[model samples]
Target chain A: MSHRARSPSTALRPTRRALLAGLGAGAASAFGLARLARADAPPPSGTAVLLCFFPGGWDQLLLLDPRDPSRFTASEAARTRIDPRYDELVGLGYRPELVRPRAAPAMVLGPLAERPGAAVQLTDFAGRMAVVRGVDMRSVSHEVATRYFLTTEFPRGSLAQGSSVSTTLTALARPARPVAHLSLGVESYNDRHPSRWSALRVTSADDLLATLCPAGAVDPVLADALDAYAREARADVYNRRGLVDRLQGARAVARGLDRDDVSRPFRALVDDGPENDALRARFGISRGDFDGPRARAAMAALALTSGLSQVVIASVAPAMDTHFVGNAGHARLLGEGLDAFVALLDALRTTAHPEGGSHLDHTTVLAFSEFARTPLYNTYGGRDHHSAGSCLLLGRGVRGGVVAGATSDVGMVAVPWDLTRGGASPSGTVLTPAHVAATVAAAAGLDPTAFDAPPISQVLV
Target chain B: MGRAPRRLDAGQLRASLLHATGATWTGDRRVRTNNDPSGYALRPATDLVRHYASALGEPDYGATTEPDLDPGPGFLRRAQSAAQGACRDGLRRDREVPAGARRLLRAVSDGDTYARAPEAVRANIVALGRTFWIRNLSPDGPEVEALLGVFRAVTEREGALPADGWFAVCVALATDPQFLLY
Candidate 1:
């Protein structure tokens, strides 16, 4: 409830002994950690957060939020007589003739409607997923919408931005991990979290490799030269305690890295070979594009399993600013990307934990976009940006198979809907980006009240 | 004349070696891409030292932001991943890359003193010190005298590979905070 930032420094850094104890009374050797002796580990219910972003805006009409098609059919005029907005869609590009609404039980599914095979892998785990269609994103501009969606801070001021959901969740995770937040080609914002907890970014496995490995060492004789000169140089600036401390701290980390035992695992992860073929397969990296969502998924699994990192930020597909290609382009990209995303979910599900259950059972996923597309097609045959956006949340502690919120048939504006129940006929509360954000924050062990919206408890298990 | 910073990253450390000794990499094996976002051409070690840029195994996820991850703005600000003593023996005591080492010694030494051991030692010290720090050097300074003593002692101990001792001496100068920071 307080605006104060969380600090774990006062808490003893997780000791190997405590980790073993918390591994629970029965199974301490979940991932063969009986000998590893890692400490201060989270309980079995502890969650990992995966923030997957696809750029530009998504077309909810053809994706998660589809309009009901039963209103039309036998008498097209009769359809809108009951709901006049359906008749006006003709002037817009809502081609009743071309649009085919497939029957998905109890939920408005679009990607599957147009094409039966679209994102079919998702069908198996649809029970674990929840989609909220009517989100009044407030801004239709891509930059503003994107920034607002991630950081619940309003777009009124530029510098008013705070730590993004990814950064916040990353900082909230176990602090003892060697690499806490791993950003694989993700653009994120952080405002005043602990210095060390700042994100460690790498674009690809190669970047990860480069970061961990040193160029060859300087000559031994030259090393001594550097050593002697450094010691003497210290006295000249010894009075500047701040500078001296930074230098010493930096040196201490470097020293720890130099040890062969300490550095070997990092180096091993860098160089890819046959051993990683299965991982490459798991994330659906067939051709092995390490910058794709597949790569992020592959590397994220490694980071979590290796004890190298906690929160992983990544993207599923890019080039979403589809002013040129329209729904055809959007559908093509989303279909393929969703397949990769499903593969990632499967991989996460397969990853074994030291405690009972798969990694997905302990992981939470947020798949989002800035906003949705205009219900009507534009002159260029593509959809313009709209304020109504759809967001998806899945994984541990999420109440799945639920759809929240609705949109008007005419302009596709997010309509008011009931969020809470008991006294009122309808719990009509328009879900904003803040409520969505807070729901995610609460799931990740953070105080949601720090942001504008309270947690939408209905979605939480 | 003074400290450049608390530490210089590995790339700067390598550049200091090449610059201080006036060593020319004559092989001309160009390591950098024609349009590498990072201005500096990469050596094998330099490649390892540079922050992630067009690294192998990376995907082409962007139609915009070529080379990925908004690399241009932060090209100059790659943080220090300096793994302490991890790279202490980067050049390796065993590998014999002699021609480069020989050329370095000759370039730093006054003419004719390079081949004859002990003759060009002091002039070489002043020359290397001047370039390594990117400033003029006074032969009278205690740091210079102390560096000269280090070279002589190392040269004696390295009887088989006496040139390495000189190379080691240069390493000391190059890794100095003044040499690293600026």
Candidate 2:
């Protein structure tokens, strides 16, 4: 019998299109079109970078290898067995020219020695880098930690924990831009962090139209009836609730509706554009597969280049929380997704901005998450969440081919760094999520201290 | 045509579960299994739930399996039946809660917590009760909530409620999204 013969009907039929359509107009309206409305130019040192978040805790040990077997614990022996090519990735710089091959050749950073099935490697990347370990977050709960990481505020009784570092930075850096903060996929957390940053969400091709188009006058009769209803509703709520900010934001969104140039949908934006074919081929995406993360990233990158927004956050789908399967699943999803993400960056780096400049030198890409996985494998062969995780910072200004922190043999030990005032390792000084946020803020030219946290001096230029 | 079951290759299954539950495997290890050494079995969802809950320090909120409630034969059918039964029970719980409590529950249960909940809780419950639904449903699967985009919604909504009854709801939702979804 054929494979489809054994599967349930629902399994064979695609469920994504219906899923996208079912999403509410409000949700769909979040992503706007790519337009270049010249506003006050960004600061002289303006930088635009992509921040990709892996929602679950990632296994840093697997991605950044430790070289010495003596450093390995009994549990981390499996990691020592990683393909030496990844260890080589430690020293490999960006190879923008390579096309057919998915990733650049791995550059081994340190010496390697084998013990049993495991092999240990070494690197100088960790030395110049700063890894502040053992930072105690107020809540071990995933939701709380997530909120803490993004907003630098402890999860409180209310859901709106605080504005995220990105939103805050964008707000402070470029207050004049319409879509200062743009989210390409699903918004993270429950708090209106995206909304707070005046972030416009664009998850699909359709959303692109709803957000950017100028509102055409509706049928006079229907418009009159709807206007009357809206007037009453607005008076009832706005007058009583004192929600001026919401009303203002709503008005701004409304102004974009039906606007001629802005209304042109993403399809038109990409249909014959220079990057269109390249995007489709590179991401392995087709018109039919337009809602997935790869498609979302491509769309968002196109928007960035078009100057529709200053900051864009894209959420890739197919969760990366690999519990039962160890290296292979993560290698394929996280590793490959990351590889594709880098590929997108490379594409962006090469693509000139609509205004006749390259976005590569101006954009900085930071991939991060809430935490890291434990050193040991479970009975089911999975890893658990640990507080200290690794983040990949890649851009023109960012120091490349450098491992910013240290991990011990079993991957449990976080080596110390005393460079920053509070930058310490798991064994020594404690670092807080706020510190990382501060680093990002400083890089964006926002005041880190505004959020009551100092920027991680070492990671910044 | 019947497609081959996406059999969890030992490595893939390990990776999927780890990413799904945020659990890690460490310590002196040998790949021991009840089945053959090379051939590993995918643990039942219930077993996976239990392991995950324990790791997350959550209460064991598994489905109540009475001999009387057995629907028999197919696992998916049985699970569906259990879910319906759970929803009915959740409705009973919802009825006893106060409107204020329900409102608070709704705030906490918004988004992922609300989606993963039994239909009864999503419909009938409010603030704290909605939060309870999340806790009862997916205590070990917080990341699932994140993936669903509900985690942030609940957080954003939390601010609209009063403080006295709010923190408990937040904690409940945090633990709930994890426990209920898996």
Candidate 3:
């Protein structure tokens, strides 16, 4: 099934090009063809949503509402406790159906008491809020559903199997050096797609230079010979694919290294300038504290704020799929790690550009898991896989203090929305991941139809 | 009431011992030792030769006590001559067999042990003993039969002999510098 409608909101106009040229080619190219590009083009204001996926199904009942009596059961009552953050939420007139961070920038979603499967929130970012219910994924396996969530195709067709929303968006809007697309840590298999435009992969920044110039250690004679060989090889590859433009662009980028605007951000970070140090402090990290995952995040954030990448896809190790143990063990493990991750994101939001500007208002953060856990406690004392789950969208574009989906007790099942009216219901309406991907594409100014899915209207401003 | 022993050429004895064991000789004139023997953690030939030489009460052929021979292609030929001389002298002396040697043979005979020593060690020791028997004990006699007494005594104490003992002759041949390098 594909989306048939073109975006009526996006008009292709020629006058727009003349205005863009007057502004700057770099801004125009970076923002894609939709937006009006100005020299001081406000650095392509958009949302930076992170899909924090727990690949295996996460138990929604536990996460959305730990104290739901019908779901938690009498035997499990002792295990359930009201989240301390609930009162802070209630103080804001938001329902205490689920636990939230005590010091979050915004609490836009809460437990839907009537809805069994779905939960959503509205943040303080803008009027934009979303509560996606009843997402029906085709595959039950962890790998399949993960691909489906990011790309929107179930039993993911080979082409879409490893593709993520970030990769697709980056390809559509090819940003420059730092703001293209950066995958931190062990990137998902989906980030490897060749069709993407942005240079999305990096194990380390040091590795990038090494790959470009490997003969740095050799004798002058040997180095010269190797350089010639490399040039020949590169030329042959470029000639075969007729990618002279790309090759030339790469060469130009290499030459532009000495330019102040292009080199500023990289120099600031690698050299541990004051701006970089402040950013690290905000994140509660130091240079020595950089692990594989955190280092990637730091580098990506640096790149993004510096305009080196338009999109950054960063991930931590998988933690959500708790099969054997239930509440006390597995859930706590996930919860604590998530707590740290949220803190890191908060810190990143506070990080300023080297020129003393904040990334918070401009960045849109979207965090979610592959799917939510089962509705009821199973024989293993843990939740099995469930199709319905929750996601958090927080940024300047989000509306705060709103709970989007309804929650209720329906024998054993909890649905996202009302199936009868296609509105809010206890059982949520079937919201697929393709819908989420579509929304992200739209926000980036691309026609969501190009991705064959309609943007979730609830989340769009 | 003893018969006069027959004598055999060192080269023939060395070739016989090598044929008895199955190992390719890499020409190198390095004496095998526990420290730097074959440049690997486990060298079957080096270990075997050491075990056999020690059992026969022969001079530590694996020691660097001897000056380095030019280790040219003739190194193997020289080792064979030296092994023959030592073997003949050892048999004539009838030196008291050590308890460890008897235990090793007993273990091999009883099927309880396979000599797990280095290949070079076992090969050198066995070669020296066999050469002695051929030159001083019996020239035309079966070498295996001649060594059977010592082998039985060692195996009986230790159980089955280690399978590595079978490579004794091959280790001797590989002692040449030409065989060890390249």
Candidate 4:
């Protein structure tokens, strides 16, 4: 196989027709032309991406990368530095055993996946899900590891060095969405991509409403004057940095938010009217629980279904950085996050897409944490941050029911894995977040080479 | 080579608006919570500014080292939203004072219309131009006429109150790019 490295600017050439079209009457300035020139042709597949970030390091042993409890018992703790201490986990709702779905005999999920309170279980989508284990995160610091995974570029002194994967995919897809990228309770960076592709970051539904809703009632005359004056003033100004045009475009989007009544569906979240009773029941969103994982998942569903955004990065899980008695709640925390992810999957599956099948058929989901916890408990009875991590990729172009990569038996360290053959290999390449990102890019119908890493082709259909 | 123009960040924008208009975008006042020993007597806009800080490209000061000076649509919308509230308060404050003591709507009186008092209305537009953008304009110039055009159009419309023109003028000045950008 051969590949040529190209900058994002020159990777795909803009045809003369595209160039002329992009250079609209209003966008004739050098900066405007340059920005529009970088605009990507829409992806051929019309695939949307949902990047689910599980904040804090999650314990993979309890979920995606569980060890066989019968073999790695406490009695063999000395030989194997790892411990399947599920017995010590308090308030654990399910028995400490591996979940081997009959449909997917090759896949083995941990007991925590079946932990109570989750509306949807991991095993529910067994045939459609794919798990990539033993990813080498390369850093244990929360900030470092998170940015590394998010951008696939290691942070320079905890500072993100590149655009987030959400921004990248949004730039590639360039869907004509009101808010192209919506980020709920997640950090999104756009260092190189156009500012329009930047994440419209909000912590909760109310915050999102505040961002999208028009300002409070003003007299019609005043509103008309403000609108007319703004239009006239903007027309006269030509900002060298294209800020004027961007601002005008932003204003138009704000008007569109009002014109289309985009905030109507989201208002159902805060309003406890009978109209929202069905929505509340659908995502398990309790009254006034507008910022929880379930609520975020519901918002993700609505955002995608309503064509409000092209990519959404939602933190569907709570912080699992349990280094003390907090570990007692580790299973619950991890379970709730996974449950939110499950709910999101269910929501995608049940919701009908504009094209034909369910939204899940066209959406790609990548669920990850900064890293995983240590194999063994610390003195505080909780796990410390571990370098090895795992991720879940499924839906839209992913080869389902596949487990690709493995950690060592003793120390739970990431070992070399054959991307092609799907197991530990002495001479195989070690999986990293870069490879995971590349695979998602590939799954989204983008050239994974743009990420400068090869997609694990074995995981793609 | 000339340096490129950079935008005023959220903090700077908020401060400038406060300094220029003497009113900020106010929201519901903060009340005492169980976690608070002394109830926070913060001004109304304090919480609002913080709430929409990210929307306006204010850096979190920890992870984000510099403000996001992108001037993107999100920032523009939030800024406009904030301006709506602040300009309303500004007009209210202006109306409470006598014409001479007013910060905005200086030359125009409560019942002044361009048809009845065109000179006073044009003078107020000139005053607003100076206050908002530090620009001096002739009363007959296209700039003042443009503002008068807004005023004339508003007051001429049915169901329009005379004060609506001034409120419109207030919003137009405050939200204009000349006032927002440095």
Candidate of highest TM-score: 4
Name model 3 segments beyond 4 Å from true: A1-51, A54-57, A62-72, A75-97, A100-131, A156-162, A186-199, A203-281, A284-289, A292-296, A351-357, A401-408, A411-422, A425-429, B1-182
Write the residue-wise lDDT of candidate 3 on A1-461 in tens digits: 00012212123323422332232223222212122223542343444434444435655554432344444455543444212122222332335455444333233233322122112211222233334444556555565566667666664342234456776766566554422455543233233333223233434433222112211111222212222322322222223322332333332332222121333333323334455455444333435433334444555554555454557665543356776665545444454334334444544455443333455445555556666665555777666666555555545344433333333344223345443344565454555677666765665455577465566555555
Using Cα atoms, each model's DockQ against the true complex is: 0.12, 0.02, 0.01, 0.27
Model 4 off-target regions past 4 Å? A1-45, A75-79, A117-119, A216-249, B1-10, B28-46, B54-70, B114-156, B159-162, B176-182
Best model per DockQ: 4
User: What are the lDDT figures for the candidates, one per model?
Assistant: 0.53, 0.41, 0.39, 0.72
TM-score of every model? 0.64, 0.52, 0.48, 0.81
Error of 4 at A318 (Å): 2.1
What TM-score does each model's chain B reach against the true chain B? 0.47, 0.22, 0.23, 0.83
Per-residue lDDT of candidate 1, residues A1-461 (tens digit): 10012222213323432343332111213322243333544433456777777777877766677665565332452323212123333333333322322222455565432334333456566677777778888888766777787777765543326767676766666445444566666655555454344455566655565444332222333334444554555434432423343333333333222221112222222235543444454555644354566666666655555445557767676547777665556666765567667767766676566576877777777788889887665668667788889988888767777667777655666777766641112447777888887777786666777668676676777
User: What DockQ class does candidate 1 belong to?
Assistant: incorrect
Docking class of 2: incorrect
Instruction: Quote the positional error of residue A122 for candidate 3 in Å.
Output: 12
Candidate 4 or 1, higher DockQ: 4
Question: Residue A229 deviation, candidate 4, in Å?
Answer: 4.3
Q: Which residue pairs collide in model 4, if any? A: none
For residue B156, give model 1's deviation from the true position in Å. 12
Error of 3 at A337 (Å): 3.7
Model 4, CA-based lDDT: 0.72
